[model samples]
Target: MVDHKQYTYRVIWSEDDGEFVALCAEFPSLSFLAPEQSAALEGLVDLVRDVVADMAANGETVPAPLTGKRYSGKFQVRVPPEQHRSLAIKAAEQGISLNRLVSSMLSV
Candidate 1:
């Protein structure tokens, strides 16, 4: 049997759009969009599997989890109330905590 622990996907809901988004927490880069949370999650899983398979075929190593020491910093910004609400809703629908969503975007 193939090793199953190599890949995994997670589902999150977006409150603003009222739809679910899939995120591959294990492989942060793998994500998918769908009308429903379940569909998005399923799609992400398949996508990650395909990516892993392709990497294996090409004799490439699957990336390992992040481990290097991370730096800490802080900043402040102003956003309209409506925009903040929309962002919160979107974060909720993606099933990710708002902090994570914001952090991910900021990192990018």
Candidate 2:
């Protein structure tokens, strides 16, 4: 079983639930809500551990933790033709490649 701690976990206040909610990115469907942030996170960790064990016991594929994965620093994004043209023109005006311009925009 994958280590539950290896998964990407986040605890945030949920306006709808009026409680702190813990979420595991890899297991989108799973969440734990509690009045306290620590409790929410701990509960979600236990939930992830159990789910991972069950998946292993059932011989089902389990998702790899985001922390354990390698990133290539490259991804593809598609934009509308007009938006693409605008971005390209902006990049040219700035004397930079589209990729660099997009990277700068995203960084901001």
Candidate 3:
């Protein structure tokens, strides 16, 4: 049995509807809206559980949730030559490695 709680869920406020919107990144097409954030999250959990059960009953593959996935904490990004030079100069001025400077910028 799939544990719905293991899924990655988000609750965001909706200005147009004046309520909270619940979404699971693993199932992008589905959403649950409610006035309260907790209610929206609960609705999403129930919906995901039902979908998992239905898929299992029909012998369909239930997509895995993304919560437990591992990441390497490293990735590459390309920048224009001018921007790269500027960043390098900035890092030198700060007396920090370019990698450390970029990592600190991204955390913000």
In order, candidate lDDTs are 0.73, 0.96, 0.92
Q: What's the candidate order when arranged by decreasing lDDT?
A: 2, 3, 1
Q: Candidate 3 on 18-66: residue-level lDDT in tens?
A: 9999999988998999999999999999999898899899999888877
> How many clashing pairs per prediction, in order?
11, 0, 0
RMSD of each: 12.3, 0.9, 1.8
Q: Evaluate model 1: give its lDDT.
A: 0.73
The per-residue C-alpha lDDT of model 2 at residue 31 equals 97
* Model 2: per-residue Cα lDDT over 25-105, one tens digit each: 999999999999999999999999999999999999999999988899999999999999999999999999999999999
Clashes of 3: 0
Q: Let me know the TM-score candidate 3 reaches against the reference structure.
A: 0.85
Q: Which clashing pairs does model 3 show?
A: none
* TM-scores of all predicted structures: 0.49, 0.95, 0.85
Error of 1 at 95 (Å): 39
Error of 2 at 37 (Å): 0.4
lDDT of 1 by residue, 31-74 (tens): 78889877897787778778877887888886653343255666
